[model samples]
Target chain A: MTADVAVLGAGMHPWGKWGRSFVEYGTAAAREALADAGVDWCDIGSIVGADTVRGGYPGYVAGATFAKALGWQGARVASVYAACASGAQAISTARAQILSGLADVVLVVGADAAPKGFFRPAGGDRPDDPDWLRFRVLGATNPAYFGLYARRRMAVHGDTLEDFAQVKVKNAAAGALNPLARYRKRVTAEEVAASAVVADPLRLLDICATSDGGAALVLSSVDFARRHGAPDPVRIRAVSTVTPRFPNTVLDLPDIATDSAASVAPPAEPFRASIARAAYEEAGIGPEDLSLAEVYDLSTALELQWYEDLGLCGEGEAAKLLGEGATAPGGRIPVNPSGGLASFGEAVPAQAIAQVCEVTWQLRGVAGERQVAGARVGMTANQGLFGHGSSVIAVR
Target chain B: MSRKRTPVVAGWFTGDGTDGEGEADFRLLGTRCSACASVFFPREDVFCRNPGCPGGELTEVPLSRRGRIWSYTDSRYRPPAPYVSDPELEWQPCTLIAVELEAERMVVLGQGAPGVALADLAVGMEVEAVPGVLNEDTETTWTTWHWRLTGTPGSAEAEADAKGAAGVVA
Candidate 1:
């Protein structure tokens, strides 16, 4: 609401499985972003990294690790881990540093070199850790959690598998236009339906793959940006990192069951919905004012779920809105213009940062083929595991 | 000789009596919140997850001897997990059951008891939580739970082991 930080530059390593280290990807993205911002790496006052658990040690030391890889300038560094929302958290960390005047310029980086199959827990028989326990006990792969969500939708919303596949179709069609997207080929509903079922009601095509990718952003204070001969830069208005209210009733991933609604009535809005509401409130904007949104679409059905969660449409009507192509590239408010997890797969920490990078690019009108037309305002909404709020709003 | 039959998981159930050619007595292992009188399946020991109440001691608590089948589904594909499987072997569907434990007021998931048919199980059907073999290595056996549908017509297949399969929490 007050003097927010400006997004001076953004960069990314194309999303794919390269089987390399996370540091390599983050360094490359960091170099690209620094070059784009025309700011020397040494000039960056602080660095923040979004961590990836799947990527071993470097991913954990992400911020300082990437700084060391880039020939450490001794910038104050911080690393954050919030599952898929890691990148947004990294950006929020950098924003806080910038807005606090502790740093005139900040570098935010998030990258991941993911595993081949279902992301499992670190080698251990630890029954105490919920992440490990879920895998050990239920064998609920991430897709199974996605499956549970999809099934619940079918039971409650009368949503069909066809509706889910169409989301893949729409996103893939848009992905075809994104050069940075891993899978640029257009997909059909028939094709999606034919793909092997990874989980009940969700086919292989319906699920996003694990990928190795990187994204970085160069953020600066508004005063610094203006002084650097960059006037009217894209401004980051809000970063919502709110947690869920009490009486949590929804069954989230890695959990065996939902909290009992019998104890207290569940809240009207879910955690994801609250994520966007907070961002909108902070930005002094609403969904009607948005030109585009980037939501975590881990599965095709999940994208439609985000539609309701982000208040793009009322609950259970996401399927209808999607069927009408309201979320496509040319739609009224395009969702996932950066191809989403559908095309990019999941690069973990990098994905949320990548969303902000897309919004920055779109607002700057530099986004080549996948640009949202006349985009003035954009919001990237995502939720991290174990109740972490990760969403960012950028406006021109 | 064929591989020596053993419990798939170790330390889950006691009383070594086979239900058929390859089975053991069933028990669902969990921990009880000594503070709130609540129970958690898959066991919780670090701290009582109940936020409203003051911190309490947690001890290993056995779950309900029997439960009702709240919902059921089948994994047509092999689940990748602590679940061990052979890629060389042909895949067979394993029935996944969600059972509602009355005392815990929580649902636990497990494979259906051996010989329990997918068609025979239904919502609200009386079921019992029992120990089942998940897999085994030469050194260790991974034990887990299963829900055997009870009182279904022509359920003699599950009758012999029904009572013992669903173990009472000690």
Candidate 2:
């Protein structure tokens, strides 16, 4: 097999409600990434963009949108959408193009100008749609799902509200250092407690907000990197886009119910674990080799679930790890040193790419206050709505 | 005091909501195949989902109205469209609960009635599925059913019924 592609550059438009078009955010990120990689717009071989459902439709397929904004350099363009995994899908598209010799240098970008509140599907009255059904029939919201997971964790793992609050505390402390984050101010458990309850079990502080942000990356073939005068580069070792097995046990987003295990036997690993397991299998690395992790912390308790899903600790031991500070910056494995969704809120398509951005920074020893010391291997894991799973492993 | 509420969507809960009191109050829902039963909620309108064996036609089934709280949460933030929220008024958080159905063997999520609060709910508490209004406009009122936790007895039977429900999910 051909060696992995080199992550030549990573860039972002600092996340916030800038009240600008997504095209602006995406173009800015793309230009910054091109500049960082020292690659002229004309030199790039291909472009892949993660499309976000925008005003009236997915505004501008990210690739073409950015290309048009960048003045249409005539690079081969491709766009992919996988909900929250859109960025990872874009990265995967770039990797495939490079491996197939379709392009020597590729640019992958994702950006979104999110609406103010909970993300809902386009205005519709479709009974055939499960997403619409959930909202229409049950009035079930995203936080409702997050609350279900939190309550389940408490019942099964005995994870306390305090444990969930600690995740916020640790992540907020780390987020305090992330200038790119929307909420740079640190949060305390007491503050989390005092915050109004948005959903039961999860309060206002426990949930991630919606924000506008953009992230882009420049990737090139190993040979291209060597010829470009860069001796060593952070290599993208694995890009896992795994789908769930037939009998998916966990209740995921958009779906009102989980796949019934009543008929077929359940997989040894749950769907979330399988997402990370596939990445580790592809990368030839285990959780122990990871210097840090970036997980989708939609809620504080969900982050604790991810701790178990990523094999950071055994089931029911996530709270213990938190208690021991194993996931804190100075602790064993720093999880969400970019402050996670707790600080970054969420930029959907851009969020996953941003996770890789954080990993790239940490691996390069550039993550100032939240650095995981001597970091070598880092992994970013996330699951998009529907069945899309995202995991990217990078190494120095 | 009220106009009327018609179930906006059909094939969901089957019961007489307009009746002040009647036997039709018991909601008739969907049931999975006993042999190759794969649970579904919103009453699976079609066939059994089990992959391993002989397929069979689904039957109109009545799910257990009373069950225990498998889990509960709420919508702190107003959800996006298709979900109705009155922006003119300050939004209030609603209690969302997942209750295990005994005969269908799955969990269904529903909004708690007006008085239910998070403090009133806990895992393993007793809950019952009750129909509620989903949305309202001048022309129409959307009606739906949800599980509400009741701090009561018979939770063991509810759990057992959920096991028997065989896998119907919300």
Candidate 3:
């Protein structure tokens, strides 16, 4: 296993549709993280920025842009883009810098100002781009894909619409306690059923909305953390950023078809399962050791999918686990204690970092009302477009 | 004014220029890796995607027309472009299906044939790819593929519905 990086501080700008530039939100989050870490901007040896592709030219050079916004001190900078996994990649970069002795302290930041309505591909007639082709040829939006998965779950696992609604109820309740969450009002199964249908078998409330937000983290070498008078801190034990193996059988996003499995057999473990396995292996911990988890609830059904993938339960047992309250707050293993995307909506670039921030607070036992009791080990799981797999394991 | 019949994206399918006036031969086209025996839809034109295989010539291959429905869903709202649709027209929810081709062992996604409602479909139901219009503009008729249920008299009804609703994707 690789050496761990100490999570010196974690911060967020509070998710919302605030109609502000991403730079503003990112700067605010970065400043908060720096203040929390008791590290000055000029003292940081490196900075990493998770890019928001929707932010145009400046978004492409996010590292330099955020560095400029925070006032340049010639710190080493790097930018990464991996759709929803962007923030995790930024965190990975910062952790790498610390472990390699390249930087004693590094700052990671991600932010976004999302547009209204469904996210569309960049303007073009490029049939070469699968994201564009899916929309152009089949009129298949992101919700359409979610609908397929939800329906498949109903057919395969006998999961009911009410079961999906309960996930929303569970998450919304927790989000109500988190001031950073955008949708603080607790949601009910009745309300979820009453919401408009965006895709078959999935309602508007089942899906996450796009939002404007930012998240930042200050990471340092363990020695640095000890020298800085914080002997015990939340440590990042693993950051898994794996890609799908060949012959991926699952219908992933931005693709019109799955890779053929005729010649080569499909992997025993699917992509999402592998993502968690890699993290668990590196962290040297299993699901039994998890005090809590922060999963990407892009859709309520997807949260159930994560349960199975994360090994919280066996395959096809996710609904049963949820039904038994195993995943609810104060239960066996609380999930999405910060409310997940269901409550926070999706700030894309900021999301993965935000998940880590939640885990950090829970591990530090400072997650006021929604804290997982006696939390010591926590994990965050997220998947992004184009086979980008992300998961982070942190422990105190 | 007569608009020219065109494939939405060329070389993805086989079609004749009858433009729904006649039963033009139609089939979805894909490419197969000669080295790895792997198949790709939307026709991979360049190199073999299989990492185990050394570079080999990709050959044009027609995919199996018949398959089983792996999953299905319907879009209740209008999708944003580059999917061409008239904003003036009331949105007609379109059923989307993911069909599993046994021969290729791959799942291909397509719009369900017109009149095929979600209530009419179930997992593992048989489906076949057929020629259909994606959208139309002043000078171009964009031809594409649609997956319609196979077996029983319901298949006939779906075909009739598709013909009746020709060129109206939304």
Q: Which one is best on TM-score?
A: 3
List candidate 3 segments past 4 Å from native. Answer: B16-24, B152-170
> fnat, candidate 3?
0.87
Top of the candidates by DockQ: 3
A364: Cα error in model 3, Å: 0.2
lDDT (10s digit) by residue, model 3, range A1-396: 999999998889999999989999999999999998999999999999999998898887788889999998999999999999998889998988888899999999999999999999999788889999999999999999999999999999999999999999999999999999999999999999999999999999999999999999999999999999889989999999999998999999988999999889989999999999999999999999999999999999999999999999999999999999999998999999999999999999999999999999999999999989999999999999998899999999
- Which is better, 2 or 3, measured by DockQ? 3
Model 3 residue pairs with clashes: none
Model 1: per-residue Cα lDDT over B1-170, one tens digit each: 33344544344444323334323344555666666655554555677666765767777655666777655555666666665677779977766666666666666666776788766765667776555666666764555666677554324335544654633232
lDDT of 1 by residue, A40-146 (tens): 99889999999988767777889988999999778999999989888888888888888877989999999999878788777866765777766766666778768
CAPRI-style class, candidate 3: medium
- Decide which is better by DockQ, 1 or 2: 2
How well is each residue in B86-110 modelled by candidate 2, as lDDT tens digits?
9998878888877765555566667
In candidate 1, the residue pairs with backbone N, CA or C atoms under 3 Å apart (3 or more residues apart, or in different chains) clash, namely B8-B141, B8-B142, B9-B141, B9-B142, B9-B143, B10-B141, B26-B130, B26-B131, B27-B131
How do the residues A1-396 of candidate 2 rate in per-residue lDDT, one tens digit apiece? 236889999999989899998888888988888887888888998999999887335454778888888887789999899989999999999999998999999999999999887777666568888878788766677888898999999998899999999999988888889989998898888999999887788898999999999999999998998898767888999999999986676777777766655556678988899999989998888999999999999999999889899999999999999999899988899899999999998998899999999999899999998888999999999999889999999999
For candidate 3, give the lDDT of residue A68: 99
lDDT of 1 at B168: 28
Indicate the residue-level lDDT of B53 in model 2: 51
lDDT rank, highest first? 3, 2, 1
